[model samples]
Target: SLRQDHEVVGVRAGLEEETLGGGGSSQFYDLNVYLNELLCIARLLDQPFQQHFRLLSSSLSSPALVLPGPPKSLARCRAKAQVDYRGMRYPSSAHLLDVVRTTWVVQDEESLLEALELLLASQIPLSSPPSSPLRSSSSPTPSSPSGHTVVRVKNGFRRRGGYRDVKINVVFSSPSGFRVIG
Candidate 1:
């Protein structure tokens, strides 16, 4: 039905134009006019198919956007006690510490680092008695007279990679709770 309708219109237009005696300069001009009309019809016929093909190809190449489910290991770990911090629940103290450390590194703010240091210095019990059987009970954890905790630092040098490849997480907390000035 569509094919017949198009053909009828084209034939009627051609007949009307021929009867109107529109002046044409040469054979080349007539040929060019014919080609232009043919091209217009071809484009009209092709548009729907082109759109359909584009949609089909895009769907085939990529998955539909959908919310992801919780990670399997995280789901299992969630069965244990969770710590609430910064409006989020973490599976454990270690997880919370890791997240805090990562946030500190990502933000790269001097104030945040200082705040973290203060929080760690105040919260963590640095002078607790040694739990090792070899060490005496009277010996307290190492600290400076100014109340700064003494930390042992060991540097591991790698030949191939730069600092960008390395990730560091530092956790500091006192027995009471974690605090930041600003």
Candidate 2:
């Protein structure tokens, strides 16, 4: 089985922030939401994901090269922000993966901070409102903006017990559609 050959290398956590952007919190949330999605994939192969993946080690190397020796090709990936017709924040998980690799890397305190930012970004959407709308609306837009879709911001805070906590706030959108002004 795929899991048998490759140990269920722990899920990749916040890397986007480490390499690119960051959230305004020291504590980061786990991508447990992605776990359900991954587990669902594992179950397809009749495998149980029990093993955990922690950071073995990391340093400022030239990064992994596609081919060995000089003239090596770097595996580069870009993180793009996606916005739905309605404006909503979709955390850039794909960007995080491009940064620190995975969450297991947060062994030390400093790395933890970086991890938190990346993880937070992953949880949220990567998008901003378009400068100009493709089409104009004759009717006045709703106050909420996103309409039925809701936008939530969960803040991650550091605690005394060397752990972090998250608080979530849900905001309903207005009737017309959500707007990403920023």
Candidate 3:
């Protein structure tokens, strides 16, 4: 595949046999450049020769977009940013636990339900000394079906219309009482 370009040029000039059989595209060019940059960074850092030697021994592969960031920045924004930094250190030390993931903000009821399901799935059960005590619904409620357990999170929690950053909550459990009441 890399020889396609060579083949075309060779046919036009009547020197098909002498061409190096190289078919380099724009992507191939970009990949070569990216690899060169990566190699240069690794070399300048004074990493062991064997480490650089390994990458040199293998064929170079192209990536769509390769943006490297620092590990400390990544750790701080771990909750918000989804980054694959391979392994690099930053120049600063900062605690960044509270970075909110923009994707978590839901605009509609359908997305709200989806987000609630995802959140509920991630929650661990309350321990013996419960942080918040659970209470049963006074009478029949729409959100909780007859057979299922329910704890009213807060009154007047509407799904539709304009949204705010109110913390809406719900929990569901099995009949055998592997329950998650929040």
Query: Tens digit of lDDT per residue, candidate 3, span 4-63?
Result: 012210101112222424463322322243223322222232222222223322322321
Write candidate 1's Cα lDDT for 29-131 as tens digits.
3224332333333233233323322332333223222222221233222322132322221112112211111111222344434533443444333333222
Best candidate according to TM-score: 3
Superposed on all Cα atoms, the candidates' RMSDs to the truth, in angstroms, are 36.7, 20.8, 28.2
- lDDT per model, in order? 0.26, 0.25, 0.26
Candidate 3's C-alpha runs over 4 A off are 1-104, 130-152, 155-166, 169-182
- Give the distance in Å from residue 11's predicted Cα in candidate 2 to where it truly belongs: 20
TM-score of each: 0.19, 0.19, 0.20
lDDT for model 2 comes to 0.25
lDDT of 2 by residue, 104-174 (tens): 32335565555444434333232333221113355333332231111233345544566563422212122
Residue ranges of candidate 1 with Cα displaced over 4 Å: 1-73, 76-99, 103-125, 129-163, 178-182
Ranking by TM-score: 3, 1, 2
